[model samples]
Structure formats: structure tokens, C-alpha cells
Target: MGHRGFKSSQTQRGLAMVELVITLPLLLLLLFTFGEFGRMLFQYNSLMQASRDAGRFVAGQAWNATLGKVDLSATLQSQTKSVAVYGIPANPNGYPAVVPGLTTGNVSVAAVGTDHVQVSITYTFVPVIGSALPAFYGQSVPLGLALTSTVVMRAL
Candidate 1:
């Protein structure tokens, strides 16, 4: 017969709690780390897509020489910024709620050589878990990472 005074169940009463106490932080750390990394990747893809869209627009556009030297590059730049940020004509607040601090200034449309148009996007990513975790890669992981994407296409 089992011990009459002390039950086997009683001895294991806090076993799960002890295990949780030891592993909870580790599990949470991994969870948040993965989440933050995923977010960074998602934002990166979004930036690349946006830049590609802008590139497509600029490449297929016909240059306007209506105003002598004024040209339409400036106007094209505005449209490119709008398209890249909002995926539409205009959305004063930049992208949706996914990427924070993205603005028109972060996008650049430049003419490379005489036939190529380049669209570049720059963003600073601040990680949520980075601040709480230890430093890695010889720097504080929490320090914002600068992500940049560029797309270039020949002018039509």
C-alpha cells in the first residue's frame, strides 16, 4: 500500500508549478523573439513590394517635357511616394498600422543614368523584445535596424 500519511499526489502537487517557474521566462522570451523577427521580415517584404510598385510606375511612365526644363519628375516623385506608402493615390498617414514611422520622406525615386528609374525605401525597425533581451552581434539588439529596399527598371 502507498504511504498512509502522505499521498503520492500531494508530493507532486507543485511539480508543474516549479517547472513553469523555471521555463516560463524562457518560453516567453522565445515567443517574443520570434514574433519580433517575424514582424521585421513582414515589414521588409512590404517595403520591397512597395518599392517594386513604384518602380513599375516610374518605368512605364512617359516623360513630360511640357514645361521646358521643369519636366514631370517632381510630379512623378509625388505619385510614387503616394503609391508606395498607401498603395493608392493618397493616404496622408502613410502605410496602414503595420509599419510605424513610415512617411513620404522615407521613399526616394531617382533617375539612374538615362533609361533606368530606381525606387528606394528606408525604414528603422525598433524591436519590442530586443530591449528586454541581451545584446548580440556586438551591439544592443534593441537598437533600431535600418532596413532598405531598392527596385530599378528601365524606362519605357
Candidate 2:
């Protein structure tokens, strides 16, 4: 008589080890990519916050006729290590030697009236991980990530 009991062959089997081997690399790659993106986003946010702080400080100041040119850039440069004022011909690349992990670009400050001052901070963001993608040639990778921020405020 034929076997009347359930047969292992008839039951659906779980994923094979080979299947896991094939997908594990892809999963790990996706995880690493996501982590790198998160880090980049955090750095971008920090940069924006720094810019806002500097702009606000400048804007809240009382207008002084004795002050010829408000050196907001110098004030900001002293406040943080990652902030600097650009426009030095020696550093034409806009990379501020004083600031670490930040390259300062053009900064424009204009008096929008008698009681308002506009401050804009422009900077170049260099990705930590994306910049190294070129070393892994023949592998698919993302590179060349950059961002900028601007802030405006009113004088007190």
C-alpha cells in the first residue's frame, strides 16, 4: 500500500541557505547607504543651525553710527570652529583654513532699511562617505553631495 502519512517532499520548504547568501549582501548594502544618508542629513542640519545663529546675532544688534562695517563674520568665526568668513584671495577655493570640516563661501550682509539687516551665509558641504566612493571602482556608488543655507533677520 502507498504511504498514507504526510510526506516531507509534499510540504513547502523554507528559504534555502543559498537564497540568504544571495540576498544578504544586497541587504547590507542598502543598510549602509541609509546610514550614510542619515549622517549627511545630520551634518547639513548642524550647518544650517550655525548659520541661523550667526545671522540672528548680527540682526539683533542695535544700529551704531560709529560702527563703520559690522564685522559679523569675525564675530561668528570666534563663536565656532566650523564657521568662517570667506573672500580671501589667498584662499581662492573658498576653503577657510581656520574652520575644520567646513569650507566657507560668499557671505553678503546688507542693511535692508534703518532697522533690518540681511545676512546670508553660503558654504560648501563635502560628504564624508560619498567622497570615497571613487576608491571602490567597478562597484555602484553615489558621490558628489553638496548643500547650502541662507538666513535673514531683522535688527532690534
Candidate 3:
């Protein structure tokens, strides 16, 4: 009876090892998924804040008291795009974008309903693995996710 118990213990140890081996990959995948989700959320939050900042900046400057409306002048729109992309009114030399791959082209500023200014930012989120997955059976898989943030504030 004692001998049989020792044999079962050894088999149990082997079973545990096999179980770990089988589940390890799944566990790792789950962990990476969670980390990626957190990163995505963080990037989204940054975009939201940047849009808010740009909206605030534009709302304060876009109002034309004489015109009695929000002005979407070219200069004002350009500056708002700069603020959305670079956190500044001007895009300085050698200054990095607020978000990776973010560009002035991706930001748009417009007058909304004659009284409000709107700032919109669109960005693509690239995963840590890469922007696209390796082709499987000649079909390419894209992994980039698009995120957009828009804010409207009363022109000051």
C-alpha cells in the first residue's frame, strides 16, 4: 500500500507539470491582452485630454465680438491643430507629436452652430506586436485600431 501511494505521488507531480505546460500559453496571452487593453485606454485618455485642451484654446480665441459668431479662420484652425498635435500654439522644430503618428492632418477645427468651437482628433493605435499581423494563407490581417476624440466648447 505504501509503495502504491509513492507511485501515485510521482504521477501527480508529472500531472501538475503537464497541466502547467498546457495552460502557460493561455495565461501569457491573457496577461498580454490585459496590458494591451490598459495601454489602449491610456492612449485614449491622452487623446481626450488633448482634444479638450485644443477645444479650450480655440473657444477662447475663435470668438469674434464684432462678427458676433465663432470664427473658423485659417490661422485659428492651424493653431488649434498645432495645439492638438503638439500641445502648443506653434509646432516648434524638433518637437515630437503629443501622440505617436499624430499629425495636423488628423486634427480638424470648425465652428459649430455659430456659437461653439469643435476640435476633433483621430489617431490609430498600433499594438505592441505590430500594426498588422503576418499574412496567413495569403490573407493580411490588420491590427490597427482607430480612436477619435471630439470636444465642443462655447466660444469665449
Candidate 4:
């Protein structure tokens, strides 16, 4: 009876170790996935806010009266900064500073028509620990992700 009891205890201990080994990787994977998903959500929200602010500024402006002297870009840039905007890239002409995780483009204005503007932002997200997965595949596949958002508005 004593020998049987010892054998049963050893078997239980081995099973516990096996269970832990199987569960630990799954637990860590879930945690990392959740973290990446949260970051993506936050970035998407920030881009949306920035686009709305840019559109509002364009809609609130008055047409310039000076001939050959209209500089709406400056106005947009100022309003963008005043609103504490983020996640929109700067213009190539270096008018407004680019947001760290985003890029902006395709801005235009009309003289005798409604002023039109577009704001865009892009983000690249990477998993916290998933980057190492490619090694197991013998360097066969690459993993990368990107997201984009765009908003447009016309002056009233």
C-alpha cells in the first residue's frame, strides 16, 4: 500500500507540471493580444478626433478679401495646433508638424465654391511578442499591420 501511494503522488505531480506547461503559453499569448487590440482602438479614436477638428476649422472660416494674398494653409495649421490636434501628418511644405503616429495629405481649397479639405492618418501596429513567431517558420513569412483613416468637410 505504501508503494502504491508513492506512485500515485508522483503521477499527480507529473500531470500538474504538464498542465502548467500547456497553459502558460496560452495565458501569455492572450495577454499580448489584448494589449495590441487596445492600442489599435486608442489610435483609431485619436485619428477620428483630429479629422473632425480639421473639418470644423475649415467650415468656420471666411473667404479672404485680399487678391492674390489668400493663405488658408496658415489658418488651418493654426487651428489644428490650437485644438491640440494629433495623429495627422504634416504637409510636405512643412506648414504643420506631423503627428507621431500618422500622416496627412490631399488638402485643397476653392475660390468661388465651397472650401474642401481632407485629413488622413495612418498607423502601423505590431504585436508585443508575436514578432518572434516567424523564426519558427524558418523565416518564411513577415508580419506587419497598418491602419488608415480619412475625413472631409466643406465650408459653410
lDDT of each: 0.77, 0.55, 0.90, 0.54
Write the residue-wise lDDT of candidate 1 on 29-69 in tens digits.
89988998899999999888888987887777724445322
TM-score ranking, best first? 3, 1, 4, 2
Model 4 has an lDDT value of 0.54
- Which of candidates 2 and 4 reaches a greater TM-score? 4
Residue 82's C-alpha lDDT in candidate 3?
A: 90
Q: Candidate 1: worst 10 consecutive residues by lDDT?
A: 62-71
Error at 52, model 4, angstroms = 1.3
lDDT of 2 by residue, 1-156 (tens): 977776676354654667888999999989987887887677667656766665665665535556643434454433322332422323446564432355444445556656665555554545555444554558665565655656656655
Instruction: Encode model 3's per-residue lDDT on 1-156: one tens digit a residue.
Output: 456535655457678789999999999999999999999999899999999999999999988999999878899899999989899998668588888889999999988898998899989999999988888588779999999999999998
The TM-score between candidate 4 and the true structure equals 0.60
Q: Estimate each model's TM-score.
A: 0.74, 0.57, 0.89, 0.60
Model 4 residue 143 lDDT score: 54
Per-residue alpha-carbon lDDT of candidate 4 for residues 20-112, written as tens digits (9 for 90 to 100): 999999999888878878976776676567667665665556334453222356656554444324323333444443334343332232233
Best candidate, lDDT:
3
Residue-level lDDT for 89 in candidate 1: 50
